[model samples]
Target: MNPPPINVQPLDTGTTFRSQAYHALKQAISQMDIYDHNDEIRLEERQLSELLGVSRTPIREALTLLEQEGFIRLQPRRGIFVIRKTKAEIVEMIQVWAALESMAGRMVATQATDEDIRTLWDLFRNFEMRNPKEHVNEYSDANIAFHKSIIRLSGSKLIQEMTDNLFIHIRAIRKLTIGQDNRAERSINDHKEIIKALERRDVDQAEHLIRDHTLGLAAHVEKHCDFLE
Candidate 1:
């Protein structure tokens, strides 16, 4: 039996080759083509390089990053396979992220200065202004940044490290989930409420809102997206 075909756009040479290759492939996995009918995806370095019209070096670099982020597993001389999480694992990850972000939100409320809150509102504007129909992908990146900013304000090296570690895995799942109906708009609203809660210096409210945002994401993804196993 033949393997499925993949269609990837040529890399934009304007960017660093590695970044170009990475984003191009990531976008393909996000939308265009990669997965098979069996809900799995596989590719070799040679196949990816040929598909993206780049050198093997950039293809290898992108695959390494993807593998690190838990999107793909590269078995030596076999091929790269997509590593889809189960619904149970997805719920667990989101629960942890909710706990982490809720802690970060509370810390931000208690510890973040007026200027810090001001910076958050300023960052919030980035998402506020986004046209989700035209810019969901960009909005997703901003949403990640918005959550990270609050976590950064926590001023604990440990919290920062944990959130950073969780983000790579979470991001891959988010890529699939964000395109769901009104997901971008809904996420923006949730962030708006969360920021307002933080700015009011309501610790409990901030924690609740942030957890709701993260867990809401879990529920949304569970309902709408398929976790390729």
Candidate 2:
């Protein structure tokens, strides 16, 4: 199925304000800037509004959206707090991600244009060449771009949206993985193989490569990372 065209609009004043506020709040929450000293940290709207230089309305709106996505929780009078993932929850999310990515790769193998393949190959090459010591952020950004490009090529808006939402929850775990020695190198190699499979229009190979690569990353997190504990 083809994705509906994305409508890009000129930024109006209200759209700009809400977008700025959403980004500011999202960064703070994702980066763990807000903390609660009593057991778990709750997101305080007043503090966020003051810190982000926005009003409570937009802050509340953003919190509501995040809460709906399972990124955060809102307790009646207790405040909003980030939802920490359990080991089982993390594993389940990883399984779902693997399935989605494999499906995406299969679709891309059949549907991707030459331009799509070229752009993805360039991004993968750039990711491979990044020096971990000096360009970790660049490498991470490129890695995300490459995967997002594949998802775009799948031509499914609903799947793309769900995959993006999962990424939001997995972003912290991914940061932890990025710090490991040889992890980035292995990831680049896996991406290269997947790109080759796509280039050949080998749907079976592409699906297998994508699923295995994602499951390998999940295994690393389950074995070496304490995020689930």
Candidate 3:
């Protein structure tokens, strides 16, 4: 069976149409479960054009940009499909992300306000009194949010920009694996430790815990996720 059609909003007239359409399409793709075991999902230009309330001309232009960014591929006669990275690529990307996030944690230890730390805690407050394993889906969303909030708390625009693309893959993978191997149960604990380190403003400890937590995901994908092979 075919996966659902790409979701997009009509382009805002105030912005340049092609750029607006490009962002719209990319956002939709990022939210898709491209790693799903189903057949590769295709992107139809006509459908996209109609959905975005634009002509084929701008849709074509927007697609070309997405293609160039390594987000999608266009085959001569086959169709456009989202690009799914191989296991090696996924592991390498996770490794890079681990480095970026660890540094972000260091910055957060030194720069984030007490309220920022509390806000991070708020993400998991409900789970604090319950078992995360019982609510894997909700915790997965909060897990992704927790990492993003840490980056934002770092107060480094460069780090935020660097991890933006990595997140496209990381979020998807985390959602898929969070329920496996009792991972969600372990993840909640790891997050609590990292947050505690940050709260104490322990830079070295925060960096080490954050790096270990992220690198642990890389190791999990490397050993487990055989589908990526």
Candidate 4:
């Protein structure tokens, strides 16, 4: 199959090309469905150079940075490919995310204003009685957005930055798994409960609910899914 398109804009002349290329490539990789079994995604230097209107040198430097950050793999013979975490690796990521996001939830409960908490209600307002099975893709996006909102609402720059790489995996996993079994329906209910806890400013309950919600995916992957197999 053809490699995925390098979705980058032409670089501005002011900033260094290597830095711009790194961020652009990282963002593009993060947005891709890198786990699709049928699509063996690869990155090409010439293609990225053309897309970014720069030479291959900066692209190479940028790719090396991304490789070090665990976003892509620099293979000797097979070419550059996006990194897909193994099952155990993904579970570990979810555990780490659970810890960070749960603390974010605690902060949000204690610090976010009523208006800030109310914003979460909008994410799933339209999906109230609808069948998530029929709209799994859309709901999956909303679900991911809701979790991101939690991190943002926490008002912790460190937490947000820490989860940056984690989202590259977490977003993919959530999208892939949300429609499985009866997880989508249960997910909605869980979100409602979490929101209520946040609204009531119940720090412990909010933290517990958020942590358990994230950790549940780790457990599911451990016992149920063949995602990494």
**Model 1 Cα displacement at 73 (Å)?**
4.3
Tell me the TM-score of model 2: 0.78
Error of 4 at 153 (Å): 0.8
What ordering of candidates by TM-score runs from best to worst?
A: 3, 4, 2, 1
Query: What range of 10 consecutive residues in model 3 has the weakest lDDT sum?
Result: 32-41
lDDT of 2 at 142: 70
TM-score of 1: 0.66
Off by over 4 Å in 4: 1-6
Off by over 4 Å in 2: 1-42, 51-54, 127-135
TM-score versus the correct structure, for each prediction: 0.66, 0.78, 0.96, 0.94
Candidate 2 lDDT over residue span 96-206, tens digit each: 988998999999999888678777777755544555535666676676677778888999998888887777556656655664767777777788899999999999999
> Candidates 1 and 2: which is better by lDDT?
1
lDDT of 4 by residue, 120-226 (tens): 99999879778777899999999999999999999999999999989888888898889888999999999999999999999999999999999999998888767
Expressed as tens digits, the lDDT of each residue in 1-229 for candidate 3 is 6775677888888878898898898899888877756578789888998889888898889889989888899998998888888989999999999999999999999988988898988999889778898998899899999999989999999999889878778888988899889999999899999999999999999999999999989999999998987
Q: Relative to the true structure, how large is the alpha-carbon lDDT of every model? A: 0.75, 0.71, 0.89, 0.90
lDDT of 3: 0.89
Q: Model 1: per-residue lDDT, tens digit, 25-141? A: 765654422322445567777878877778899888988997887667989877788665676776788889889989988999998998888786665565455576468677767
Best model number under lDDT: 4
lDDT of 1 at 95: 88
The RMSD (Cα, Å) of candidate 1 is: 6.1
